[model samples]
Target: MKKILIFSASIGNGHNQTAKAMQESLGEQGYSSMIIDTLEYVSPTFHKILLESYMNLLRLSPKMWGKIYHNSERSRLIEINVLMLLANKLKKLINSVKPDAFIATHPFASCMLSVLKGRNNWSIPIYTIITDFTIHPSWINHHIDYYFIAHEQLKYLIDIYREDPEKFKAMGIPIMKKFREPLDKEKLRETFGLKNNQKCILLSGGGLGLGSMEKVLDGLNNIDLPLKTFVLTGKNQKLFRKVSKHTYRHEVVPLPFIDNVHEYLHVADLIVTKSGGLTTAEVLSKQVPMIVHNPLPGQEERNSHFLLNNGCAVHATVSEQLIYFIRELLYNPIKVDHMKQMAKRIAKPNAAEDIARFIMEDMASKAVSKVPLGGE
Candidate 1:
């Protein structure tokens, strides 16, 4: 079996989840793949400092983070510095792993590997997945062999940069294999102990402490509809405890980090979530309409914009808007059905399988033809 090395970052679970999805798909295609958290592996201290600083900034002062995010279009100081720090460690890892190709779910991984491959004359491929609705400049570079984007509309990013358009595969973002399969909603509801008579509203903060779920839950208490709500306070014990202890008008169930996210999604009539790329993709794949809460500046805002423009989600700027959207969507089945249709129309449910097949076929053909590997 051909060996594949995938590099991911821990900025959020999205990056690692993206990498794992690809790994699982590739494994089904008879490939040996492994995922590495490059950020933590390269330097644990730097990883902690970076993640903490980023989380704090987004929580405490999001405008400052937004300014830095936008200014990065004209400058790659952070990416460059990360690339520099990752170069030596990544080189050692690659030499040790000796894989046939490299895959990156994070920009830092791709940028560093692209440069290192050219400089060291490594005969391996480097593929990247841009896991967002919008393509940031940091993810754009000349040396990557191929890019898998979330949508065809984002092809303009490649076209405007004078890169070969064929280098991009707009195959949608790869999601878990389980998400692509058909699920029984009734069974899912039974598994999760959901009430059949009440409306099901699933609220998630996108696996990170990114949104105001407590405030949203408090507002939800005022909704007069009969409801069963599942609050996914993922990996946040404090938040989970608080939400679990809090009283509400309806049955509010709190869940910690769960392995069966797809199941909860399948049983939800409506979803209120922060607009992270992975969660959005998962929600869309399940054909559930969304109410996205106060998105953080930068990519989250961009993701929310894409969802709003696509007609599958409501962008709520504050608690009131979020509550209003929830009430409206809950009572209006016609609008909810329309949004679900739109989501189904745009959802790439076969993204993981298609991407796996494409990579496998491309690699086999390249090997048969003996073409030089690892270049743009």
Candidate 2:
């Protein structure tokens, strides 16, 4: 069996989630794989500082983060220097692992691996998985063998920077296998104590619980509709406690950090979430209409734009607008159905399986080419 190396960073859940999905898929295909957090491997101090700074920036001032992201696009020299600094550590890992192929789910990993592959003259294929809907300039690297993107529009965006259209594949974002499996809505609702007749709205703050859960729940309670809300505060104990104390006109179920999020998504008629890449992909896979709330100003904002442009989601910057959008969707089920249909059109539930199969086929072809014509 061949071994695969997947590198990801822990800045956010999306990157690690994507790596795990690919690992599971490859495992099912009879391959062994390892997933490593790049920053954790390179420098623990740098990783801690970067992760804390990122969370603080997003919470305190998203616009500032946006400015940093935009400025970094033009800071190619600085990015190159950073990659050079980390090249030795990455090269050591590659040598120690001696894997057949490498995959990177984070931009930092991708950039560093690309540089190391070139410097060491390694022949192993290196694939980059773009975790977001939009392609950032920092992700562009000439040494990458393949670029897996979330959508076709992103391919076009990357083409402006690198003119190799064939190198790009719009495979959608790889999500957990559970999301791809068929879910029985009635059974899920019953298991979760949700009423079948009432509309269910799932309010998620992503893995870190970054959004305003209490305020959103309060606004949702004001909507004069017969609805049941399932709130996932996601490791934010304070937010969970605050939401649990409040009583609303409708039924409110508050949960903190669940492993079975897909089951909750299965029972929901609609979702209210901040537009993180993985969350948006999961919602789209479930074909549930979404109300995006307070997306952080960088990739989340771009993810929001993609969803809104595609008509599968509505953006709400404030509590009143969120309530209004919920009422609108609930009162008009036709519109909700339309959004669901749009989601179904764009959803790629089998992306991880597809990617795994593609890599296996490519490897087989290369192996066959190396064989002699007459078995000499």
Candidate 3:
């Protein structure tokens, strides 16, 4: 059994979830995989400060976040130094695991892997999975063996970032194998205690559950729609309780940290969510249309554009717009059908298998090259 190391951070839930999903994916394909949260391995104080500061900035001044994203592109020296420190720490972890290859789901992981390749002469192949549809300059690095992009348009974007075009493989987003299998909508609805025929709308604020869930739920109260609503307040106990206490006559379910996300996706006809890469990918895979709320500055904005252009989702800038968008989606069957069809066409059902196979083949070729021919 070949061992593989998957690295991610805790700043957001998507990164960690992606790492876990990839592990499961590899297992189904008959490969052994392990996940490590690099943040936990490091000093807790440093991780706490960094994560809190980032979330505070995202919540308070997103424009500043946007500027940082823009600056990351041009400030090569700064990025390189940060990468050096990250690489040194990750190098120790990699040496212990001695993984056949490294797979990174976060941009920082890619940056650090590049540094290891540059400064430490590390030769293990590293594959960076670009979780979002739009490519950022920070995600582009010279030493990565390959890039698994969300779509073909991003391949062109990477060209502008100066990466060789041949390195990109349009493998869609890596999701759990459970999502790839066809779901029984009626059975899923029953599992979640949802009505058989009534419309179900799933509202999620990504893994942090950072968005204004209560505010969005309150706004929905203003609209006179007859759909059942489900809000996934992930690891956000305060938001969960606040939303749960609300006395809405309509069927509203408030869940905290559910393991069966695909079941919820299967039952939802319309999903209102933040434009995180993982959320958008899952929604797309389930063929559920989306209404997006406030997205984070850089990658989230790029994801929003891709979904909008692809007819998989509609954007809502403010609370009112989100409410109105839900109303429209609930009432219009034709538009809903159109969005669902578009989503099905774009969903990559075999992404995990493709990625696993890619890694296995790369490892095999490398091993073969080291053989001594005509050994006595």
Best by lDDT: 1
CA lDDT of each candidate? 0.83, 0.82, 0.76
Candidate 2 local Cα displacement, residue 314, angstroms? 0.6
Instruction: Provide TM-scores for the models.
Output: 0.93, 0.94, 0.90
lDDT tens readout by residue for model 2, 205-279: 543343456566667766776788887877778877876787888888888888898888887888888888988
User: lDDT score of model 1?
Assistant: 0.83
Task: Tell me the tens digit of each residue's lDDT in model 3 across 31-97.
Answer: 7888767655645676788789888888778899888877776765244775566567766666666
RMSD of 3: 3.9
Candidate 1 regions exceeding 4 Å error are 79-82, 206-212, 368-376
User: How accurate locally is residue 261 in candidate 1, as Cα lDDT from 0 to 100?
Assistant: 86
| CA error at residue 83 for candidate 1, angstroms | 1.7
Off by over 4 Å in 3: 76-78, 205-225, 368-376
Each model's number of backbone clashes?
0, 0, 0
Q: CA lDDT of 295 in candidate 3? A: 80
